[model samples]
Target: MDAHPDPSAPAKPSPDPLAVIRSRGYLRILLLAGLIGVPVSIAAYGFLALVDWLQEYLFTELPGVLGFADVPLWWPFPLLALSGLLVGLCIQRLPGTSGHPPSEGFKAGGFPQPRELPGVVLAALATLALGAVLGPEAPLIALGGGLGALAIRLIKKDSPPSAVAVVASAGSFAAVSTLLGSPLLGAFLLMEASGLAGAMLGVGLLPGLLASGIGSLVFVGLDSWTGLGTFSLALPDLPSFSTPTAAMFLWALGIGFACPLLAWGIRALARIVRPYVHAHRLLVTPVLGLAIAGLAVLFAQVTGENTGEVLFSGQSALPSLINDGASWPLGAVGLLILCKALAYGLSLSAFRGGPVFPAMFVGAALGIAASHLPGMALVPAVGVGIGAMCVSMLRLPLTSVLLATVLLSSDAYAVMPLVIVAVVVAHVITGRLPEPPGRRLSGALPSASPSTV
Candidate 1:
């Protein structure tokens, strides 16, 4: 008889895509994920607290001790110059070159080696506390990954490289969950950056979700216990928003079109500054810091708002920009955008922190100013601008949308359609834009290139 007779028999089923994950070892990984979260969350919290304390002491308390009621317009000049020197020393002398360059933007590099953690922490602390226009996310990611790898090596020396990577990613998920105010959002950000997909996505996400959930709880408990409030992103008391109209859609398109150009400009400026930074870091970095300080002074003198609005990563100042948009004149808002954008570019080229928050702040300022147009409302304008800018800068549309909308509380759902449109348009346009020219110099600073350990 022909073998074709076997067709009558039951067909063999295809194996489940997740069969490998369903194996016995996965449960162990899951348990380890939960355990890793506890210490990672605590470490993340400590890092944020230390940065906060340092910022206050260096910028505020020190000024008071010197007999000034508040930081003077000239204060940041010297302060930032000193910060640059210290940061430069850390990067040049320390291993891991004090983590990756901000110019490369946010990337999900795998776990850092054990020895690299100190450099990452010290560099980030210096940059953030000294008022660099950068965020804390990048350093936290590096720290979490480093710690995770170290833990794995100590506990299971023979663990496969793949297992180490999974645990490291889980550790990162825990580290950032609290900062973003949502474990889900943090997971999405990391997942997108890592390019995880399909069966692998599900497999990877399970442990990460476990770690992030526990981490968020740890953040809550710590916040409650210490009364210091969580370092998570929050925007309280947002103004109500109306349903998006044709006029708002039109404005969204305009913002979508404009933001890519802004992103390109920032990238180009950073590329241009990189060579100079590499050639004369100690000099160029300090000069860039002074330039940032000068911009702050100019913004303050012109807008009469506190210079603090223009300095640092712009995380704490974002709420004021949104809530106080109506009170700020169009001219003042415009000046703030100009100053912050320039400062942001300078910081990216020379500093050692993430680029997310400063970009958001600049975009928020742009949106608030655009609200002055007849059709645009404050809430929609703010949401659209942020989404568009973030997508352009970070190239992660989902994370950008969540970040822009979630801050609006209940208004998030209402404006989400508009935010989506803006983000899509910006992301597409950004992709079509030409890449920045390659650096002429070879074998430059370790952080200058995008490669991660």
Candidate 2:
């Protein structure tokens, strides 16, 4: 009979060469990742452009219009005070508390909601454009994550929560791809921050890589079109580094031990100031701004150098500092370090931005000064100091090593061993150090409803 089928017999499924891909839904998610990356990258470009324009107008053009060809030392005080008030208003009124505290470093926080994006953008614009001593990384990360979530919800209304998280991660990767100057570095930073491991790591990383690759392309294109130059970290002309001598290794150990203590002191000071900042945010934030401005003024008066050296996130200034290391007197470097560190600490307590760049600047300064001492060369000392300080502050050994070495370009290969040693030593010591008492870890806020996204 033609229709004789056994009820108990299992039906055979059709074979397909791409069944693995279809079963895992890899193609769909990857396609979605590519789609997610384009908008996120554009958003990142736009945000950076806005900040650049604002910074120039507020800090440069505004001052020139006020009859000063260059920003006077006293300019930052009033400007930052006003910025503090504006940022304070945002934090007081806006959602997501303007993202997160700078004191927490980088955390594995989930994506912020679309509603929270404005607050973040406003606060960061106020802080950075007005000369706060913090980096753009934290706000960029928040914006990227928020945009990612918002895009997915709009495109696929019924996307699973898991899928949303993956896309969000990819968006963050794409957002930071150009900023870090390497998509690989951005991927590593996100991967390490996410704490993913084993087979799960590969699965999670694939989408991020795809997004980052696309984002990097967008960054290059936009950078070309705008001719603004990619605001990426680069040390295009680093002095040659020699093989590590015993004295240089000794210097590395010393810096490794000392950098964590410096980081701890900064953290401890932030803990001391946190309660005051929270209790009187409007008052304290402005005061903190004034304090940073005051340091910049003091540095200028004492050293006869540009006060701008002591202000802002220290990203653009890093290359200059390294290139002109020989020009600075040892004592001036020390004073700059003290002033910048104090400003960095105050900013951490009251401002809203990332901590990575300032810490790197401080470490690099220390290294440059230490190199002035007999027995150490400048380049190797810089690499070691950056690795140690970054590891101590960020607690990300691999990323720190990459940051220190990668910026050195081919010299990175030669100095890699020293960077590794410093990173390991700093990482271990930082781990052993006791956590600051009475400080609450910055945790991720609850995700907003789909409507909010």
Best by TM-score: 1
Tens-digit lDDT track for model 1 on 243-348? 8899999999999999999988887788889889988898999999899999999999887888888888988888887889668888888888888888888898
Tell me how far the alpha carbon of residue 329 in candidate 1 is from the true structure, in angstroms, after superposition.
Answer: 1.0
Alpha-carbon TM-score of each model against the true structure: 0.94, 0.92
Model 1 regions more than 4 Å off: 1-17, 437-443, 447-453
Q: Give the alpha-carbon lDDT of every model.
A: 0.85, 0.82
Predicted structure 1, TM vs. truth: 0.94
Clash counts per candidate, in order, are 0, 0
Q: How many pairs in model 1 have backbone atoms within 3 A of each other, for residues 3 or more apart or on separate chains, i.e. clashes?
A: 0
Lowest summed lDDT over 10 consecutive residues: which window, candidate 1?
A: 444-453
CA error at residue 349 for candidate 1, angstroms: 0.5
Task: Report the lDDT tens digits of candidate 2 across residue range 183-202.
Answer: 88778877777687764566
